[model samples]
Target: MNAQREKLRMMLTSAIFAAIIGILAQVTIPLPLVPITGQTLAVGLAATILGSKYGALSALLYMLLGAVGVPVFSGMSGGMGIIVGPTGGFIVSFIISAFVIGWYIEATKATVTHAFIANVIGMFINLFMGTAWLKVAASLSWPEAFAAGFLPFLIGGVIKALLSAWLGIEIRKRLASARLLPYSSSKRTA
Candidate 1:
């Protein structure tokens, strides 16, 4: 009974985090370049606290929701068109970024520095994928893509990484204390 309850709890946690990501996606700061959104920070938070697999699940669920025509994307947009659109790469990369961040956090000691490093790498991956797709989908030159998608967001990425790392570490501590995280569980059949 306890085992089943734990499993269900984890699933609910994943769903809650996915919903958080969806909600954060709507908090956009529109710009001429890539509009800033709270989505990445949410992704980082999920990954940092949940570790690789669950973190990826959260992000994947978010993308799936959007793909199925839910308005889970920035600016209250969604559907297949949004996924195939110019900035779709970044949206798609959230899964990869979360996975990478979670994997790193899981492998490491989960220190704040580790979270910061992992998140920084994830942000770079986002930038690369977003820029690459912007070039192809929009027929933009490399310079144009960089300017419009990557350059403008460099500072913001660093800020988000730092903030997410700090906040995620605190959240992880609280969740662990409440026996809500995977690592907080002492039993395993495997």
Candidate 2:
């Protein structure tokens, strides 16, 4: 019964985080390749707080919502067409980012510094995916894609990483204080 309840709680948390990601998409800075959105922060936070499984699930749900015409995507665009569009790679990268960040957090026992590093790793994944997709879908050369798709977001990514790391630390502290997470023996010893 307790396990079932815990599972339900995790699911609810995941959905909430997914909704937050959607909300973040509404906050955007227009650019050439892909608009800057708060979605990255939400993605980082989701992974850092929920760990890989649930984190990926949340991002998947967010993508599904957009694919199904929920207007949860950036600029309020949605539907399956967007998933196959030029910027689709970055959109798809959200899942990968969540998985990478969450996995790193779990592997490193969720230290703040490690979480920041993990976020940077995740950002790189986003850049790679986004730029590659831009190259293929938009028929741009590597340099052009990199210039248009990745360059504009560099500083913003760093800022997001720092902010998300702080957010992750705060979330971890709250979850620990609330006794909401399963205690790790390794973490206890550390």
Total backbone collisions for each predicted model: 0, 0
Record all residue pairs in model 1 with backbone atoms less than 3 Å apart, i.e. clashing.
Answer: none
TM-score of each: 0.93, 0.94
Error of 2 at 85 (Å): 0.7
Q: RMSD in angstroms, all models? A: 3.1, 1.9
lDDT of 1 by residue, 17-84 (tens): 99999999889999874689999999999888887777888999999999999998898888988888
Q: Which stretches of model 2 miss by more than 4 angstroms?
A: 184-190
lDDT of 1: 0.85
Which candidate gets the maximum TM-score versus the true structure? 2
